[model samples]
Structures are given as C-alpha cells and as structure tokens.
Target: MDFNFIGTIWSLLPPVVAIALALKTKEVYSSLFIGIVLGAILFCLSMGTGFDGFLSHLLNDTVGEGDDAKSYGLIHCLSDPWNVGILVFLVVLGSIVSLMNKAGGSAAFGRWAAKHIKSKIGAQVATIILGILIFIDDYFNCLTVGSVMRPITVRYGVTKEKLAYLIDSTAAPVCIISPISSWAAAVSGFVSGGENGLALFCQAIPFNFYAFFTIIFMLMIVVTGFDFKAMSKYDERLKEWYERNGWQLDEVSDTKLQIVEHGVGAKADSKKPKETKGAVADLVVPIIMLIVFCMTGMVYSGGYFDATSANYHDFVDSFAASNASVGLVIGSLTALILTIMMFVVKKTLKFDDAMSCLIKGFEAMVPAVLILTLAWTLKSMTDSLGAAEYVSGVVASSAAGLQMLLPAIVFIVAACLAFATGTSWGTFGILIPICIAVFPVAAPLRIISISACMAGAVCGDHISPISDTTIMASAGAECKHVHHVSSQLPYALTVAGVSFLTFVVAGLTQGMGLMASAAISWISGIILLIVALTILKRIKCKKE
Candidate 1:
C-alpha cells in the first residue's frame, strides 16, 4: 500500500519511538517490535485504513497472502536470499563454535594463552589480534572472538564489559575494511552506476575514517588500560568482586556467564577446563580452515573459476560480483564438518557430542538471529513508510554547492538514521544512493560522501542497543545487552567525533584525489584520536 502520507514526516516515527523506548527501557526486542507495530499503524493510517487493514498487511508481510501479495514484504524478507543466507551462516558458525568449545578447543586455548600471555595487556592485545583475524563477517567475528577470548580475559581480570566493547569495536569496523567479507557484499550492493560497487567501495576505504580510527582507538584504550564512568565501575567491581575474591563468575552475573565461563553444551566438559586436552593447533587449525574455506566459498560463488563467465580469469572481477551470504553459508558449513571430524577423530569429542553441538550452536545463535529478523522487519516497516525516500529527498535538497560540508552532513544523516533504525545496511541503502546522485560519479566528493555514509552507519551500529552487531557482541562477551551498549557509547562517540573532523578534511582535500586525501585525513584522524585519548587520560589522572 502507498504509505507516503502526503509528504509528511511521519515516516520517521517508527525508528524515533523505537530508539527512545530502547534506551529508556534498556530493552531492544520489545522496543523494536513496538516500533514495527507503530510503523504498521502509521502505514495503515496513511492509507486511510484501520486495524483490520493493519493486520492484513502484517499477515502479508509475515505470512503468505494471495497471489496479489508482493514478494518483498516482512514475510518475504525472511525468504530473501541475503537474509536466509545470513541466518544459515549464523547457525553454522554457531555450531562450529559450539563443537570447538565442546571438544575442549576453547578451554584448551585459554589455558595455553594464560601461560604465554602472562599479563592483562597481553590478554587484551591477543583478543584484538584474534578479533582482527576473524574478518569474515561481523557476526562470526563477534561470537567466535568473544567465546574464545572470554575465558582468557576472565583469567586476566578483564571485565566482561570491556571484552564486549572490544568485540563490538572490532566487528563492524574490521569487516567494513575487509575486501572479502559479508559486509563488503552488503556495501557493494548499495552503490549504483560507474566504477562498479566493489571498486567504489575499495576507493572509498581511505576516506572511511570512523572504521579505521575505531580500531586505533580500541587499541589505545586497551594498551593504556583506560577506564572511566560505568566502565570503570564494572571493571573495578568485577576485578575486586570476582578476580580478587577468587569467586566464580556464577556469583557475579547470570546463567549466560555460566555458559561462557564453563563452556556449556552437551559433551562440553565443564568439569576440568584445566585438564581440557587440546593443543594450540586445536584452536588455530579450525580458525585458519574456516577462513580459507569461507574465502574459497566466496570466490566460488562470485564465479571466479567459472570458465563460462567472461571475467572468470580475474579474481577481483569475480569477487566484485560475489554473493556474500551464499559464500558464508557454504564456507561455514564446510568448516563445521571439517572441525567436527577433527574433534571426533582425535577423540577430543565423540560423534554424538558433535551432533549435540548442532542444536546447542543453533540455540546460542537464536538470540542474534531473532534480533536480526526483528531488526529487518522493523526496517521493512519503515521502508513501507518511505523513510529512505524522505531522508534522501531532504539530503539531496540541502546538498547543492556544499561539497565540503556534504561529507559531514551525510555522516550525520547516516548516523542518525542508523542509530534510530539500528541497522547499518538500511542506512547504506538510504544514504549511499543519495550521495552518488548528489555528487557526480566522477567527482572526488562522491567517494568522500559515500565513505561518510558507510563510516556513519558503522558508528551508529557500534553504539545502538538495537543494532544486531551490538546484540551479538553482548551475546559473545556474555555481558548484559544494555551494559554493553551503554558502556561502549562514550568510546564510540569519541572515535566518531574525530572521524567527523577527518571527513571534513577529506572533503576539503578531495581535489587531491583518493590516495592523497585518504592519507591526509587518515593520519589526521589518528593524531586526533591520540590527542583526545591523551587528554582524557590526563583528566582521569588529575581526578584521581
């Protein structure tokens, strides 16, 4: 149904009410659902329909209607190739993680890390490196890194809040920078016209200040052991309450902590983690194989080796046309099989145990998957209300002759939309097109403006409680959801502040072309992060 509402701003209501309710209630699912309901209501009202019409539309979106029903509503969203692929990918990856944990790979890895790491800084740094290494997808990165590193970090007295932040900081940030990733596929699909989506995305990387600087800022925060406000309380409280007292985390948090600390799941021997038999290879091999297989899967789906395709000889050309969702599922499924066999053959875990992990894995991912689906549905609702078109119109209208200011403006627009909607891809679908339309495809400003859209979306996702990445990060770290969001906001905003200035610099220097502007803006952003962190550290010292 037509939901334009005669050009009114009511299209913005769903996300606005949802974000407000989420923050105020420290809840995500209900808030998002409520927002979805509100948007459906708005859509109905705009069409001059009533509750019955709303139910009919909801049914059409969620379930099947007659042949008159379009194939692109809420229900159809679940069947969308991209959406289904991601869901299956999450399930498979979760199962692989579960299998590893059940077979003592994770516990064994933690024991090994504790011996070699020897310090808190080393533990945190190891987590960062591992997080960066898992640049396949943000969902995979968050869960795998969190589960593998949680035990090790806990040993070093690193707070769950801090670990959650680290997992989150690395997830969307690292994935966005990776050329072969699910995120790359999503970003690639958003841009229209010349240079191809992947090429444009690659060109825009240098201008993506928020992402690269988040990594930098995250490193500095960990290396310096900086803590402030709620983070400080949680860090010190946990350090004193659990680590200092030698109390189990069971005394500190909820059941999820039990799962993370004890490695819960059938055949997961929580009995003696110290005696958990495994080598560093048990941990390293599966991860490496997963990466390799996933990459292979991606390239394969892109038809890299398909001789029939004209671009078969060129890997980059193939990958630019790849389907991220398909490749991830294929790779993760392959990795899961190989990992299970390795565990069973080694007697690290039984075949039966591996079989049980399948269910456990799916169970673990249920929360992330459910949240993602709801987020998607909410996006659907807003989309039905024409939010993207409205926002795009506003941006295009205001963007004339303001080339230098456009990047920052796009950044703000993208950030607000992502924050309220809690979905980066949704923001991308809205803003990237507007950016390309406003600045000619050949203009340096086009690349900068597009990068701002991406960077802003990531920034918003980093902090928003309702963002799937944020929720997954919390699940991975076993931190309370709201705790993760609230604790990470200050840190995210700090990097975002510096990123805004860097975008301004980039926009100003666009005439110098990609490499020059990228270098200048990136270096400036790093300096800004260092200076900002230094000042904050000094202020903390003075307060102490």
Candidate 2:
C-alpha cells in the first residue's frame, strides 16, 4: 500500500540489466537469461541469502513452487493467477498453431489466397482484415494471420516490412477493442469487482485514440497505396529483388514451396485442381463451430441463460456474468477436435499426418512459449519490486489539478509503463487498480482518466520494439524485426501526437462527450489519409 523507494529501485535493476544485455548481445534469449539471473540476484540480496540459497529459491519460484527457503515476496508474485493463466494460454496456443501449420492448413490457405489476390495493396488490406478477425488471442492473431497472409502478400509485391506493420497494428489494437477477447479478459479481471467492467471498456473505446487511429492509418495506407520514407526504403529493396529475380523472389522459398507442392501432389498430381471436397467446408465449418461453441460456453459460464429467456440483453448479461476462460477453453478444445474430424472426413489430411501436424504446431510455438515465460517472469519481478504502485502513488500525490488532467496523465502513464514493459495488458493491469481507486475522488473526470489509461496502454504497446504483438507482426510479415520497428514508429508517433492533442482539448473543454470525441477522431483519421497520400506521391516522384 505504501511506497518502498529502495525496494522499487532495486526491483527495476533486473529489467534494466536485461535490456542492456539484450542490446549488447542482440540475442533475445540471452537477454532474458540475464534478466532472470539479475532478478534472482536482487531477490536473494533483498532476502539475506547465500548464493546457493538464492539459486534454490530462484529455481523454486521460476517453476511455480516456493518453500521456507524462498521469500514470500518471490512466492506471491510468481504465483499470481493471471500470470499462471497467461503462461498456460501461451503454451496451449503455441501447440494449436503448430498443429495448424503441420496439417498444411496454413500453407493451403496461403497458396489459395495468393492465387486470387493480384495487387500489393489488396494483399495488405486482406492481411489487415484477417488480423482483425483473429481477435481471440494476440499470439494467434500474429502467427496464424501472418503465416496465412505472408505468401499472398509476397506474391503481390507487398514488402514484408509493410506486412509486419499491418499484422502488428491489427493484433493488440483489435483485441483491446473487443470485450470477449483474452486481452480484455485479463484487463477486466484487474478492474472488474465493483465497477461496471464492460461499461468501462465500452467507454474507453471511443477514447482509445491510438487503436482507433492505427486502424485508420493502416486503411489509409492500403487505400492510398502510400509508403512513408522509412517504409519506402524497405519497399525499394523488395522492388529491386523483384526486378532482378523476375518475381521468382516473390514466390515462397523452395523449402516451404516443396511442402505445399508435396501436399498437393498427394492429393492430385497436375490433373485438374479439383476443389478438394469441402475444402471451403474444411475451413469454414470449424471456424463457425468455434464461434458458436465459444459463445455458448460464455453464456453457460456467465450464467446468461438461467432458466429464463425473457429478452436478448438479459441473455447477454447472463453470458457476461459467466466465467469467460471456461468458455474459451471449451471452445478452443472443440475447434481442435472438429478440425481433426474435418481432416478425416474430407481426406484433407491422413491420421499420421494429422498427428504430425499437431506436433509441428506445438513445436512452432517454442519461441513464443519461451518469450512468454520470460515476459511473465519480468512482470512478476517488477510487481514484486512494487514499481507500478510506487509510480502511481507519486503521480497521485505530485500532479496539480489532477482532476482536470487525470485522463491525459493516466494515458501518458499507461503508455510509458507499457513501453517499458513491452506489454499493453501488463500496462493495463498495473494502472487499472490505481485508476479505479483514485479517479472516483474526481467524479466525472474518473471516466476520462480511465479511458486515457486504456488508450495509452494500446499506444505504448503498438510501438514498443520488444512487444509480443510487434514481434509477431514482424514474424507474420517475415520482415526483420528492426525494419518493422523503424517503419512503424513514425506512424505510431504521429497518431500519439494527435491523440494527446485531442485528449488535452477534450479535458480543457470538458468534452468527454463520446460523439464529439469520435467525430474528432474521424476527422483526424481523414487528415492522416491525406498526409499518407501526399507522402506516397512524393516517394513516387523520387523514384521517377
């Protein structure tokens, strides 16, 4: 409850060390190892431990158990329910993705998509839409959408760099807006006890300036077919590759191509591309089932249909009250089972291949699994140090006219924290408690402040180079991570600037009116479109 300055400062040491190591080594795994070790060292020092005791304690805490040898600080932080859920979700999702990949589902979808999409811009738009649709999990959004979209985008001359931007933009941005998403579940769990969590989320949506505008910005780029200076640099490289290789470079590499071709050959060898019976059904049926089961599960978990079918809103209300994760787990399991059945019935996959596909799907998730584990560890360490609470206290105490600028300050704080943590959900988790507790003292301003925090978290996560969504975006596009970071930064910054301005004006005018704020956002979106177009024309001129 109270600030522990020394404890907080010491707590920050691990993440700082981790970042420094990452930069120095340019190896993500090594950097995470350094971070974990640094965190353990600090924990040991704080708890008065010898090196051996420290090692024992660290191992115990890392693997989710703690004994008398370990400090309570280490145990409680590591065993947080949210943390446990996140870790499980990451591992399971990874397994599912590996399965999808192994079944040739992803490649089949990609090849089919590529043959139809003719232009670079169209492919980018398709990628964006797919990103939006896969809102259940950001990790899923990134890998599946990216893997499926990558081949198509490549065939149409869209730079991998641009594809990364689109994928990253859509992942967290869309998830934060949807109330049923895993991201929302995490955020709501933090802020849901007394307050109307759903309403709070809906209120935040209008002012979620970064997410609102990022979508607009992406659409602008797609519609105007414009590339910024940084993006243009990457696009030029792609064009050069195409000119020399005669679009051969546009095709998938021989290894991936071979996999797809072999799968095709097994089905039918050059004799008329017979629409694999229920190929569309193979894809569509399972997805529809996923949605239906997920919704039904949510209703059951939330207690939405409790022996009465009076009205639709009440039914929805019942669903909201149910346990969401139960629904998610059930839905995901059903989808997985149905997918296997579809493969068998359609002859789309053999029993051995299907089993192999599942293994491969889990295998592909290894990197994600590792990254998630490290990320959670880092988050636990930070929480144990009490960094977020300390900062929240400082802001609550020091700021002037706190009521008036509460929203803007929340936004700024959330953004800064998210940037530091490279996680929007973590940022939201850290700030929501503080916002809920502090904002009520200011009455109406509480709404604005809470909204600001949500918006800020989204903005920060959108741009953070270390963010999982950002990494996924790059992976999805097959672009260098740095390239995605560099190309996307300017656009993200531009939106942030405008969002800040809008928040300031809204605060000053006491205009937290949703329609007005939305109108301003729309106008701002249009201006961004014009600017993107102008920039694209300039790039064209330079090329000519």
Which lDDT values do the candidates have, in the order given? Answer: 0.80, 0.65
Model 1 clash pairs? 61-75
Q: Write the per-residue lDDT of candidate 2 for residues 1-544, one digit (tens) a residue.
A: 2323334655666666765665556566677666666666666666566888566645554322556232323345346554454444444444455555555555566666767775667788888888888776676577667766766676666677787888888888888887766666566667765766766776667667677778887797688766678888877775674555444544654343433333322232334332333333444455566567766766665655556644333543544364555666666677777778777766767877767766665565566556656655665566555566766766677445566666777778788777666778777776787777775533555566667788898888887656777766765555666667778888787777767766665565455565665566556645755675576588678886
Candidate 2 runs further than 4 Å off: 1-10, 20-24, 61-108, 228-233, 248-278, 295-326, 441-443, 471-487, 511-544
- For candidate 1, write residues 1-544 as lDDT tens digits: 4545523578888878887887789888898889888888877777777878787665454323787444324676687888899899888888888887777777678666756887778888988999998887898789889978988887766788899999998899998888777788788878766557888888888788899898888888888889768688886676455554445642332222344355323133335324556677777788888889888888888888789867573676556677878887888889988998888888888898889999999998888888788777887777777777777788888898687889998998888778876789888987888887777767999889988999999998888777889988998997878788888888988889998998889888888988888888878888888899999999999988
- In Å, residue 215's CA in model 1 sits off its true spot by 0.8
Top model by TM-score, which number? 1
Please, what is the TM-score per model?
0.90, 0.81
- Count clashes in each candidate, considering only residues at least 3 apart in sequence or on different chains: 1, 9
**How many pairs of residues collide in model 1?**
1
